[model samples]
Target chain A: MDAKRLTLFAGHYGSGKTNIALNWAYRLRDEGRAVTVADLDIVNPYFRTKDAEDDLARRGIGLIVSEYANSNVDLPALPSQIYSLVDDRSTYGVLDIGGDDRGALALGRWVPSIIAEDDYDMLFVVNKARPLTRTVEDTLEVYAEVEAACGLPFTGIVNNTNLGPETTAQTVLASMEYAESVARATGLPLKMTCVDKRLINDFAGQVDSLFPLDILELYYMQKEGM
Target chain B: MGEKVLMKGNEAMAEAAILAGCRHYFGYPITPQTEVAAYMAKKMPKIGGTFLQAESEIAAINMVYGVASTGKPAMTSSSSPGISLKAEGISYLAGADLPGLIVNVQRGGPGLGGIQPSQSDYFFATRGPGHGDFHVLVFAPASVQEMADLTGKAFHLAWKYRMPAMLLADGTLGQMMEPVELPEPHDAFGTDNPWATTGTNMEREHNIVNSLYLSPEELERKNIERFERYKQVEAEECLWEEYLMDDAEICVVSYGITARISKNAIAEARKEGIKVGMIRPITLWPFPNKALAAAADKVDSFLSVELNMGQMVEDIKLAIDCKKPVDFCGRVGGMIPTPDEVLDHIRALAEGGR
Candidate 1:
């Protein structure tokens, strides 16, 4: 994977960054694009990149993580191989970074390569219901904070404010509207609005990007389309 | 007029689901988490949504499985023990890569623990409640407002990754009240979950969601493959909160209710001529280990405080893996320690047992 073909999903806690990354990765891979996933999360355990090991491997996707060590103590830092992999990348590669502005700060180390080579989409996942992020200005402030911390500019916003089982079409639409406002304020493109495939037909024409989540499904779509 | 009142974590989650366009809710009632079901029960029908009070926690989870399998945004809520009951279903969701949300309004304990606020569920949500090789996207909320807001992201992430997502909150956070600016309502009849079992008459083949992988080779490959997706998640999705860690002598690590207490403790310690800092992890799953590690390089020592038996403390030890002493102190079974208590712990740890 050329560092030039980089895909990043980033944002604060509860901002849907992982969700966007997972969906995007599946879509690209499904289109017969070779993808390798390296689980760089040494932070939170619940949803680490290691969590999706099974599904991605079944589709012949490459998976790498800290478990290479038997101590089960890998929490920080990435192998120099990651840099080499980025430097040598040919197809598409997606990286799901941990949340928090500080975590993004690590990206600064790779900014030179990231900016120079990658036509990457640094997607900002936003959940309006999250504290410290409920308004367009709130998102802009966070975007700035992340930009300064990571030393990389974000390219788009993914409106992702929805309630769990209680989430309704109303809530999804509201979230998208808020996302649009944030995108306008931040001048970041509103890349996509993720709606449950269950809500597919209802929201097909409503947003700019129809992120048909369910990673494997998109993989199938991509492969089938190709 | 609809009330624009300050609400607790439970109420906010319920209300946010509505605004996010959820129409079906299946859950069993449990303390410190009843507000979620209560709100759904009271409102789901009026808004033409579905809310079912299942016979047991397991049943509630399975019901959610049935609904979520159709590709709809479905959810269920329970305290620690009850969440344990639903572990099987959570595992299935992960195995099937189903997109769904599970709210864990944590109470105390390894077993029928207290209904009071506690962070004991940290490992359970971070790992899993069942004996399985699986994980969920866990979002830890420090306040009621965050609990409400993260609900949407949970569902969105669940769908995006084709896995289960969790909103891990403590009793204090779930019960606390706070002001919130609600989002706009989605057009209900305008939803688009084609994969949802909204009924597949002549459209396409039926969708089946299951996690029972009989083939060892298949399951092994599945495990490796899921790790691939997780890799992508870690690279781009981890999250956390940093407070005054720049050039500090020692750092205090905490989350949820304890995070609030830790913050206050830091303030007091600062006033007393101590340079203690804080790093609150917003996304517990993406534990913000890198930031903690970096800060550890600049600090003298680290102190970890939680409401459990020093559960998350292990994460701190692993993250920083520093030469400095990584001390820990906490109260369990819903016993919330005061900020002074945390300050005392910090001072004790900082003084190096002198």
Candidate 2:
């Protein structure tokens, strides 16, 4: 399947959705596609797409963020430039949403425009390692929460399971069963499976599309002096 | 003791609070401190504990007062702005002599400040949390592990002294992730206190929980009694860490997140053959005076490095009775001083003094 003209990534917090969305935006920009990565994350102050705005701008990808991003204010100020990307059909727009239902409420505002104008795909990125979505039933509950909040049906599942630095091929491969269960429960396609670039060769034929993880920045602070 | 698990400072404090037998948590959400409430919300229900997200910070601390009135371990957490709102309730809790834990994951602020980490609240926390002659036993945590450890200790100390205690952390400590070995859940200390306002059904004399004393002499006596307890806390509960102070010529004093940076600066300065050390105060209220005073007798000079504009330096000077030249190096308004910046201060202190 080709990349949808408009794509939104939504999932639970700490589900590795932001990294997946960032990797996808860079892929489109590198391929000479007109891309705009909108940071619709207002829930978490840390690990938002807005942190990488300068890097995205240099690569010719438009980055939209909250007016209060990187400042300490909790109040969100979404820019009017966001609607321009949604109205433009030529641009491959990727909305990196905040975690869970509270974050999905932000996406609800642009629902009418999203449905009326563009052929969009809202992919629910799943990571089994996160706390709330460890079990099959728990995964279904998270999907339902996001769906109910966003008022948009998820189009597919993008399995992006890992335990940060401890992740190996086994870590990525072992999540296949859990990801398949989520796809079956939601009646959605398992569109892609993400693995770090180092292990792409091992998982070529196993998944539908192997998304190589080109992680540019890791902002998670480790223990001091470790 | 359990296996060390990688966790955020906010979540670690939540776990440690639960492990400390604190079953009641009432808090309003604020930036750089919301995760503590989120973690409590997720875990408190499953464990059959009360996790009420109050309508406002004022209501949250009042809820804390209610739970603490029952002689049960209760807690409320917030950042800078929210803590300001909870000031009235905190004073009420202190005046009533209610034992509870108040976690302040401090952000930069005088009013609606930025969400980045800051130690600017040193004056607000230690000097006077609210009106009247009162002090919340403030413990400043520098690491995720201390975030967990001090939470448990704060609860125990709050109960031990029958006074309000605070775990004063900054945004960096609250948001940062590190491995922590969580303490075992202590048994609940509920309704066992002799002076608790549990209804007396002809069991004994009625116990009242309040701060009201109509007579002038009675109020003075109550104030004197509280000070006596404070004196004991100062004697027994002053906790600090002196890193490389044995042969140090320049003593760097800091606490909380700033202390972490100072420790690194001390190491860097030592690498260059500069005799630098640090005194990281785990407890901010007692001020760790004796240790700094002793160090003053030997060290050539002192440098107070903090996230605020030299608030704690005044205390450092008073602690040593102005014997040594205590210089100040710090950043304000959410800016963190780099190790190099602090190291430069250490070098300057070394060169300017004997």
* Chain B TM-score for all candidates, comma-separated: 0.92, 0.98
List per-prediction Cα lDDT, in the order shown: 0.72, 0.84
- The two-chain DockQ for each candidate, comma-separated, is 0.01, 0.29
In the range B137-225, model 1's lDDT, one tens digit per residue, is 88888866677677777776677777788888877677554556566765322345555565568678875566777899988998899
Best by DockQ: 2
True contacts kept of 1: 0.00
A18-133: candidate 2 lDDT, tens digit per residue: 77888899988888899999888878876577767777888998888877877766676677888888887889999988888888888888988998865988999988765457
Question: What is the TM-score, restricted to chain A, for candidate 1?
Answer: 0.84
- Lowest lDDT sum, 10 consecutive residues, model 2 chain B, at B183-192
The lDDT, on a scale of 0 to 1, for candidate 1 is 0.72
